[model samples]
Target: MTADTSVRFREFKMPDVGEGLTEAEILSWYVKPGDTVTDGQVVCEVETAKAAVELPIPYDGVVHELRFGEGTTVDVGTSIITIDVAPGSGPAEEPAAAEPPAASVPTPTAPAEEAEEEKPKGRQPVLVGYGVAESSTKRRPRKQAAPAPEQSAAAAIQAEMNGHGAAPAAPEDRPRPLAKPPVRKLAKDLGIDLATVTPTGPDGIITREDVHAAAAPAPAPAAEAVPAPAPAPEAVPVTAGARETRVPIKGVRKATAAAMVGSAFTAPHVTEFVTVDVTRTMKLVEELKADKDMAGLRVNPLLLIAKALLVAIRRNPEVNAAWDEAAQEIVLKHYVNLGIAAATPRGLIVPNIKDAHDKTLPELASALGDLVATAREGKTTPAAMQGGTVTITNVGVFGVDTGTPILNPGESAILAVGAIKLQPWVHKGKIKPRQVTTLALSFDHRLVDGELGSKVLADIAAVLEQPKRLITWA
Candidate 1:
C-alpha cells in the first residue's frame, strides 16, 4: 500500500515567476476542465511580468474547472484550473489499472471549509509557496464504497470537456484534448469532431495543424448515388474569390503589431534632440573595458549612456512613474523598470530590468548583455516585456544621426542615442577633432514638462561630456 490512495487534485494557480509581480493575463489555456492531463503538463500559458510563460501542472488528474478565460488578468495564487485525481494516486503516482471506486474520502464539507480558511487573505492569492495544508494527513483505510453522485457524473463532465454529446462517439483511447476557444472554433468550422482528433503535442496538445486539417472540407462522398443534380453550382463555390487571400497575424508580426499599438496609444509622446561632444565618453568606454575589475564584461557605448540615464533618472523620478487613469492619480514608483528599446526581426520591443536602480555598473553591464542576447534569439519571455517606467532607444547602432523614436506604451519617456562620429569641435575657443553624438529625449508633456525633461537630458549630456562623474553613482 505504498500507492497513493487519495484522489489527488491539482489546484493549479498562477505563479508570479519574478520580482514580486502580482498579476498576469491569461493568454491561452492548453487544457480544459474534465481533461485527463498528466503531471508536469503545460495546462495554460499566462502572460506575466511582460513575458508569456507556460505553467506546468504538479499533479496528474482530470481537470474539474477552468477558473478563468483568455485575456482575463488573474492575480497571483488564483486557481486557474482544478484537477481530480483517480483513486490510488498521489500527486504524481500512476493511477491503478481501471479499478472501481474503492476508497475513503473525508467528509467534503469540512475540508472545503478548512481549505477556504487556509487561503491567504490578499489582493492576489498566489498559492505557489504554501504547500498543501491538507496533504499533511493521509487517508484512513475503508471498505469498497459505492460511487457518489459526483463520481457517477464524471463521464458527463468529460464529454462536456470534449465539447460534444455524452460519449456520443467512443473513439479509442487517445491523448486528451485541449478545450480552448481556437480549438473549439477550429473543430466547429471544419465539421470535425474534437473527440476524434489525436493530440501529438506536449501533454496531448492538438496543434494548429490539426485544426487546419480538421477544418479542411472532407472529400466529396464518391459523387453520392446515381444522380448528383449538378451539385447545386458546386455549393456556392467552396473557395474564396480568386483575388482573396487570408493571412493570420501571429509570431513576429503579432508581437510587432501589439507593441506598436501599445506604444502609440499609451504614451503621450514629445521628442527633443541635442547634439553633444561625447569625446570623453568614448575614451572612457575604452578605458573601462581594459580595467582589471571590469574584465570579461561586455563593454559597449550603451553602458556609459545607460549609467548616465540612471544617474539622471535618480535626479528626476517623475519620469519613471505611471499614469493611473481610473484612479485619476499619478503613481510614482521608487524602483525603475528601465526599458531598453530593442529592434529585432520581430520588430521594436522595449523589455526592461525589474529594478535597474538597484544594480551596480558591473551587474547593469551583465544585464544589458543578457537582454541583447535574449532579444536576438526571440526567447525573451512575455514577463521581460512589461512595466517599463521609461525607455532608451539606441538608434546609434544603425549609424543614424538621431530620430524622434516613439515612446513605448505604458511609458512616459524615451531617449534615443545617436551614432558617435569624429568631427571638428571648438574647445578652449579653438577648433579641434572631437567625438560627436546627438541625444534625443521624448516625453509625454502632460506627465513630464519641458523643465524636467530638459534638465534630465542636460544631465545625461553632461555625464557624456565629462565621464568621471560616474564614480559617484547612486
Candidate 2:
C-alpha cells in the first residue's frame, strides 16, 4: 500500500495510571525510534507517583520515537511516544459521521441479556481495560481539504465517544495536580479530599491548600518527626523539653512526614490486629534456608508471610484496588508489587519487590532480604521504593508485640507483622512452646472494607498457622 501522503503522527502522552498520580520517572525503554509495535505491547516502564508502571502501546504502528530516556520524570499528558498513522488507519473506514455515544446506540443492537451471560462470574467491575485501539493527539495531519477548527474538535470528540482513543481532554491541558501518591494517600488516610485544596503545584492542580481547606482542624505546630508510637503511657519523647519542639525534618524522615500528613488528612484509615501461631512458618523458613537447592536464597518467615499475603490478595483483589474518583472507577491490579516497610537510620521506609506474584518462596526470600539490607544501609534507590500494591511492615523486628500501624501512602493496605516470640499456646489441645506473632492490618477504608480486610487477614493467618498448607499437593 502506498504510504498516505504526509501521515499524521499519533503522539501518545503518558497518563496517570494510578488515581491522582501526576508524574512518573522513566524506568526503562523497551522500544526505540523506527521500531514497530502492536496494541497492548509494553513499550516502556515508568515509575509513577506510587508504583513503577509498564505502559503499553495503545495502537499497532511503527514507533516513530521514544521522547524520553530512562530515569526522566515526565509529567502526565506529556507525549512520550509517537505513532505514524493515516486518519483512516484501523479497521475499515466506517462513516465520517459517527453515531452518538451509546445514547443513540440502536435498541435492536442492545444485547444486555446476551452480553451479561458471557460476563465473567463473581468478578468485580474494573476500569482501565486492555485500553483503546487509538489515541487523539493534538497534532492534526494535513488533508486535501482544510476542516474548520470546530469540525476538528468535533472529530476529536467523536474519537473519544467511539472509544477509539482516551476520554475527552480536560477542559484545559493545564499543569497536572502536583500532589505525590504518598501525599495523595496521606490526605486519604486523614479523610482529606484533594479537589478542595488550593493547589500549590504548578498550574491549577490541587495544592496542599486543598487538603487544609477540607480538614476541620489544622495540624500540630510543625516539629521534627520522631518515632511514632501507638498511644501508650510512655509518651513519645518530644523534639526537646518543650511540649512540642521544632526539629528540621530531612531525608527519609522528611519524606515520610509529608506523606503521613497527606494520607492522615485525606483517606479514612482503619486498622485491626490479630495474634497468629507462626511455628510452621518458622520451621519452613529454616528448612528452606538449609535446602541445597535453595542455597543463596535468604529464607525467612517474612518471605513466607509475604507469599501468603500475595496469595490472599489474589483471592481478594479488592485489597489491590485503587479508588479513582475522576473516572468513578475502581482499578483492580492483576499483578503484585509487594512492599516491605523497613526501619533504617533514615527512619521508616518501604522498598518493594516488583512482580512479587511471579516469585517463588525462595525468590521472595532473597528479594526481601536484599530489600531490607539495602534499605537499612540507606542505599535503596528510589525505583526500589516505588509502585507498591500492598505492603508489610515487620514491626516485630523492634520487639513490639502488636500495634495499629499507619497505612502506607498509595497502597490500599499494609500488613504489620509484629515481633515473633516463643510463647505458651494451645497445641494438640495442650499448652506448648509455640512461635507466635501478631498480624496487624491497616487499610484504606474507602477502598477496602472490614469484611474484605478481615477475609485477607484470616487467609494470611491460616497459611502461617499451618505452613504445610502451602505445599499440600496430590
* Predicted structure with the largest TM-score when compared to the true one: 1
The segments of candidate 2 whose C-alpha lies over 4 angstroms from its true place after superposition are 1-246, 472-474
TM-score, structure 2 vs. true? 0.50
lDDT of each: 0.63, 0.63
What does candidate 2's lDDT look like per residue over 186-249, in tens digits? 5776676565566654334443346656675856222223222212113346765577655444
Worst ten in a row by lDDT for model 2: 111-120
Tens-digit lDDT string for candidate 1 (42-70): 67666544444566665555765566777
lDDT of model 1 at position 52 = 49
Task: Estimate candidate 2's alpha-carbon lDDT, on a 0 to 1 scale.
Answer: 0.63
Q: Please give the RMSD to the true structure for each candidate, in Å.
A: 19.1, 20.2
